[model samples]
Target: MTSRGPIVGRGRSVSRRTFLASAGVTVAAAAGMRGGPLAHAADAVPPQLTVAVIGDGRTGVWASLRAGAGGRNLEQDLGTRIIWQPGFTASLPVMEAVKAGAVDFTFATATAVVNAVPARVPIVPLAAYPLPADEVDFLVQANSAIRTAADLKGKKIAHQNGTTGTYSLIKYLESAGLRLSDVQAVSLSGADAFTAFAQGSIDGWIHWQPATALALTKLGDKARLLSDVKTYDYAFYVARGEVAVNYPQVLAKFMKIIRETQAYIFAHPAESVALWASQGGFPPNGTEQAVYEKLVRDARLSESTAVALKPVDEAAAASTQDLADNFHALGVLPNKVDVRSFLLGAQFDAAKQAVALALGA
Candidate 1:
């Protein structure tokens, strides 16, 4: 019998369901009856890397590089094309996508990496960029009585649970000899938490950059940061383990491009800020861009010019291990995790050396 496949166009939705169900199988079958990064054939043409992009914050890498000359000529330079998948909203979703072999690369936070360690997600950390310490803060309403971290006791604070915000709150409280249970912790998404805090429902909001930047820009003097950047975490450029093991040149080329781009931005701060102003995903134009311009002018961002590929280095691992221990104490993480074991291996070491060579280091 000649079959033109199932007539899925009709109202018989079951046929449509059956047809859709075979789509994954069809894709796998087409790819030699295998799926994900591990299935790449040795002689296959260089794969198009599916990169995940987050919208809200910590967007410096994906957003800036995409719009810069650093990202141009990727196919010619790296032998790979990029398929940008934006709107993940959070790094967790991106990490999950990488685990499921849906994404090839993006920046994931150190906290996110620590969390992933226990979940057994297949990820390879290529480089670690410490979150700009000065760019983050714990913010309070200008008129609020809470003048310091110590004042946060028994106060209503809004934070996204199991995120950097929670880490900020915990560490700040610990510095003041306080604990998580001492305050009224309200768990909400970043946007919602900001709204509640701004509306006076919550006493404070603790979070990383762009959120802190947004509050300062929109609220002006009406918003006050409790202190300078409180806790520390790294923004990691990570990839699927298979990508690191199989086609490491792509990842190596990526790190090289990142180093080159950072140098370019450092050399042309004004031009870089101008580009950021024009981009939609970056800190908004006018005031927000003005904030960055001011920072660049003051040379505040100077030290971060040189980027490094860290394969579970001592300092980073120690800090991440402590972070994991603290998150466990807060009852957010079910178990204490060792950040070192999952992040280092022979595959990553080779990737790092390849990246270093690409950077001419």
Candidate 2:
């Protein structure tokens, strides 16, 4: 594995690197593409993977990887085509699509993954990206009298009803000896929540980074950080259980691509920020740069550390299980679910090994 360190921005540029070791392999390698040794076979053709992606531009790094620097097109080098199904900005809706098998894979919030299990979604977690506690928080008007979570009682709090934001808000309130009932929980999308807060329709808005950045930028002195929350918030990759069982190599290759892309992002911070800004519809200025830096800090992974892939570890599983427990108690989940049934760590490990051997990496 490459020994690239954590990706920090010092206003430096790095050359692009190919994700594949050799581009010489022929299309006949598809037989071995099912997580086995790459060997020649008859009647083989390249496979296409359909990925449901976020439309909000937060995941534009994946696009940069696919398109490559100077239009290198790494997906062609890997002998695969990616059909990107977009129009999603939040994890809850994305999870619903994946649960219905509308797409092959997606990266969803851990809260959505946990909630899906009880809803009988046949999905398995492939890997987890732990986010820093401050990535999500409560925002209030800069001049609002509500100074703490306690001040939220009897006041309107806005959040995307079934997202990690809501879960984080619940955790934040609980830590302050408050419950969901204490506040008038208003279910609103991130944009709507921001609008409501701006109009003083909502006392506070609980949301994630880029949205928070936009709010602070537009509202300026009107927006204030009322609560900085830290929770077991994770952005996790999940695939339909059938895919993990029957086509492990596809998932492994996808993981390898993401790992490589993550390393590249770390190596070229400025370029990455620009790419993300262009893709996510943010201005490539000091404000967006600051948010990107905060995202990197909260991600807390070096390039070397980012390459390690496990299906789901104990801590992640426990955190997700705890989410399920809390949601069940809060009457969010109709029935309790044993999260272990949906995790396929051992299988994912074998698949990764098989992919390494097949790719000769």
Candidate 3:
């Protein structure tokens, strides 16, 4: 396997040298198009993989990858096309589309994924991405008396019930020796929660980053965070279970592309964020858009080093199962979910191996 070192790289493309150089790693024979053996498993590549995009789904890097991140077109490298289904409000809604086959893959929370299993959503986790615990905070009107989690008692707090936001809220309440019942927990989409909070419909919003960046920027002194929260949140790359079983090669290449992209981001945070803004990553470029961008950059890069994509494994299953059990215990979930049934670690072993071989690990 590549050295268990931090991802590091630079320049316009994330070619193999970037991996061996700054990342302190070596790679397999660079004998194919663009000096990458990404297409070794091309024969197994399907026509297209429909992806759910909240904000281009890291296309800033994927675009560069598709256009030739390593001196070759990644479409030719991976032998597939990406069909993005954009404007998803959140992962819970994305899971709905996944069930109807309108979407094939998405990055959702373990909370969302676990909830999917019980809802009969035909999706399983492809890999795990540990989320930054500090990315979420409680946003309340600045004039409100709620300065601490304890002050939130009896207040209406908006959180996306089945996603990481809810998990964070539950954890936050516990820190204050309280329960969900202690607060009027309102389940709402991110957008709605923001609107409602702005209009004073909700007492507080358990805001997530990027949106949190924007909320703080727009609300200015009108809103202040109740307190900083550290959450045990994780994001999962979930796909239709059949896809992982049938197209190991494609999934493997997808993982490689993401790893390379992550390296490139680490190497060129500015360029990556610039591309993000240009690609409508942070839209509306309002007068304060730059301010929002800066805040989001701090939020993202602060913990970007922790981003790693690996096949869902036993430890991952147990970790998420505990979170699932928490929801069930809180009475938010109808029944306990066996995270193993939906994480697909066993079924994804072949794809994981394919990824290892491609990276010359």
Q: Which candidate is the best by TM-score?
A: 1
Report the lDDT tens digits of candidate 1 across residue range 262-337. Answer: 6666666667777776675355666777777666554344124235444345576667777888888878889978
Pitting candidate 2 against candidate 3, the one with the higher TM-score is 3
- How many clashes (backbone atoms < 3 Å, residues ≥3 apart in a chain or on different chains) does model 3 have? 1
**Tens-digit lDDT track for model 2 on 277-310?**
6665466776866666555544532122344444
lDDT of each: 0.65, 0.63, 0.65
Point out the worst 10-residue segment of candidate 3 by lDDT.
1-10
Give per-residue lDDT, candidate 1, residue 145. 92
Per residue, candidate 3 scores C-alpha lDDT tens digits across 244-293 of 43455677667666667666656655555556555564554454446544
Q: Backbone collision count in every prediction?
A: 0, 2, 1
Window of ten residues with lowest summed lDDT in model 1:
1-10
